[model samples]
Target: MLIPSELVLSILSYCDGSTLATCQQVCRHWQTLIDHYDALVWSPCCERDFQKGLRRRFWSLDFPDPQMVDAAMLSSYAKPSTLWQSLYRITKHWSLGQCTTSFLTNYTLRQQKRRPCVVVGTTQEYNFFTSLSVAQSGHIVRSNPMYKGTTEGRQAMIVHASFDQDPTLSSFYLEDDALHGIVCHYSHPASPWIVTGGLDGTVSLWNEPERCVARTWQGHRGRVLCVSMNDQVVISGGSDSMIRVWDLDDAEQRGSIDISSYLSERHDWFQGVGEIALNGHLIVCAPDTSGPVLIFSLLTGSLVYELKTEPQDVAFTRLCLTPFYLLTKGEINPSNRNQVPIYPNTSSSSTPTVSSSPYSNTTNSGSSSLSSLSSLSSSTSTAISTYALAPPPSLSLTPYQLSRYYNLSSNNMTTFTAARSCIDVWDLQTGKLVYRLVPPLPATTTASITDIRISPNAAHVFACVEIRDNGSRRNELCYWDFSNHHTAAPSIMVLPSMTSSSFGNAWACFY
Candidate 1:
């Protein structure tokens, strides 16, 4: 017995995609009804499941006109009878870690013998790498230096690689003679604009396709070490112990904070800012292991609060920002006898007292102690910590609105943290520990994870594990699919003994 089409539509509208898929298999009549009104059956579910969540995750990079962005996204899956099909295809592809990789040529290294190279910066859009020799020469010259190339000194090479097309490489030179090398660079995921901090204490913005400097802002007295940006402003930290905020639109200095002066009254010694994370409203600055993590307001440039972990012995290495929380990765100090404590207070003050833990004892804060702590092996004490993006109610109003009130879904979003031989995946939203991926190593062999990167979609994890073989060290690149993490073997790919030139500057991005 077949129900009326009106009744069928009414009944199925309340069901999810999986349920609708089940109903389609009952009979030809039901399948026809399902196919005819596929949009009605899937539109609401798609909006709730995919559209809202992805938009929230990528809110920082989304177009200014969100309605048009929504329309464009929906139009991509506009087939009348295949809306749910397209949604399912995309989700399954990401979950199953079904991706193809093609190696791009190392054009710069191909001309000469392999040299030590380092990755200067990377975003989901592009990867940047440079060799010490090229950086010192202040330019990339061909094998024949006399022959004039299209580009010269202090240049950045851009490569365009797409899934279906071949990669095309080109270079653009910086016009400033004082700019010797690039210390750090950042690429906006949404825009073609690239911001670079140079050794010459100057920051330059470039339009990638045109291969020319759009603007240059000079303020830092020393070389810039870190940079972060959003749609409105660019934030940079340098050896000058100053954090400068620049207006992206006009390339003018909006504000500057002398970190040394900000904390001078409290601590006798303050290291310069090492890394910084800038959302639209808040800035989190990590100076060094000895100093507390300083939180400040972007609008007024006021100190919001200071965060100190118990034991306070961890040397923070990297910081990542999300809409709701700030995450940090560091190495625990084994020399300290106390266990790490979580965030102690969330109040703001002009001069807050540093925590009285043994790690904070001023008497022990000398060069010898610092050098001994630094000499400790990092493999044994690596850890990751999370803190709220803004201070609690008494300190400040909640600056992040997307996650709490808007119902931005944050489930199943995982990030990998490495400690010695094991890698753990944690849910960023809830701070729940999910999976501990252990590399398949021999009992006699000792291994340590050097680096771990998560795919943009958070569905896959890539780890670089180093193992010693007959006194020679080798690196293995391992890939894991989170969907199959519970299985005995979730590793999809393992490339052993990757060469320096081939894999040194490699990064992965999905379309």
Candidate 2:
């Protein structure tokens, strides 16, 4: 016999995939329940017809989904029916192979001929957006999500940005140096950053970059390969063969001795310094293949430990500290597939002209080596302190290795090893290797793991393999949930098409 209706309704509420579809067609009451429940509780994109129903019945104001309309119609007066317009405006022109989440104050590069600097914010009533960061060129703009045709609705706002305040400009301790591309951390929402890796091979620190430089650090000599900071301190690595650490509070040299000065003078280029993690006594750096990250004794600047990489042409490409600061939020718009991420771009609602970078000029300076640490001196350290010694290089390992963090889930850990396509996974707590979760493809499938990226929230991790179809380079993403990873393999999720600018790539935010 068929199940009772109330019991079935209760069970169906939690049902998903095809099972729920089958239940809905069982009876008249079942159909009504399915339709009504879908519109009210299920996600807005769940029903095919419900979205069409929204435009005619709900949004008296006109809004259209950018995905459905051409660019010509995006600015046209023809408004979509109410139900879907709001959702459509929130999510349009999202792209694949990119990941996004709710970490507030991030900039979303919306549709534009050039890379557009778009600000995203939130408020109780609706979302707010200004014109794209205008350059010398004319400005491109999107209608305020809450822009009411009437004056009354104009005042009613929903989404809003954090940096509406007029921040006073100030000079920084850092000097005017050549700049590589900018990499910033918006983690400390109150005190954001514009950490620049310099061409003169120095690192400069800027406070929330509205109008001034907060602090400048003149440390590295070669191109500053990477820079990452957190609540506790500012860390930088460069081609100068050193990774320096600075105190965040007053930008003081941490610990008793200034390790920042002692080590940077030793190597030729510290190239890719991977993510950094400060664990009580150990300051760790995971870097590209150049050398082992100098884990100095934060207490003495003495090299305490080393996180070695597989010996290869590896400098760290990206380095995040131990704490995975997850910026997460829900995707309100289905087609958009990503919520507007927050960026702490502090400027005059204007985009700055970006160039190929200062390092582009110095990259060909040729390989040069330093003499010795005989002159390496900490103002606080006497010659006796200089003799204390650096960490002895790795025992059997070759010069430094090319080790990259391949995949990290809430449930598993994976790393790229020496064997080209090989990646290893381990248990998060025990550090015991979890061999089952490794990539199932043959070792010959990929040239390298350059396309691997983990979602900021750690819910999903994606890796794009270097496989080719015809003459075109075609890579596919393998997505696995952080929670169920130990028992699960990633399902392959791909871009619908090259032209598909659907919200952030193969990942979604959930918090």
Among the numbered candidates, top TM-score falls to 1
In candidate 2 the C-alpha lDDT for residue 427 amounts to: 19
TM-score of 2: 0.37
* lDDT (Cα, tens digit) per residue for candidate 1, span 150-264: 4453334332221112123223343433343566666533445666776777887766556567888899998887777767888888888888999988867999987776554
Task: List candidate 2 stretches off by more than 4 Å.
Answer: 1-191, 208-212, 255-282, 286-444, 451-457, 485-511
Q: Write the per-residue lDDT of candidate 2 for residues 1-511, one digit (tens) a residue.
A: 8667677657665542234344545678876665555423223332321122212221111222333322222222123222222222122101000111111112222232331122121111122211111111111111222333233222111112212121332112222322332332222222345455555655566543332356766666566655555456776766554667777667564532223443343344434453454433345555434443444545455654333323323333222221112111111112221212111111222211112111112112221111110111101100100001011111211244312222212223322222233222221112222221122233334333322344222234444333432444433344333221122232121212112222222211111
Candidate that would win on lDDT: 1
Lowest lDDT 10-mer window, candidate 2?
Answer: 381-390
lDDT of each: 0.43, 0.31
**Per-candidate count of clashing residue pairs (backbone under 3 Å):** 1, 43
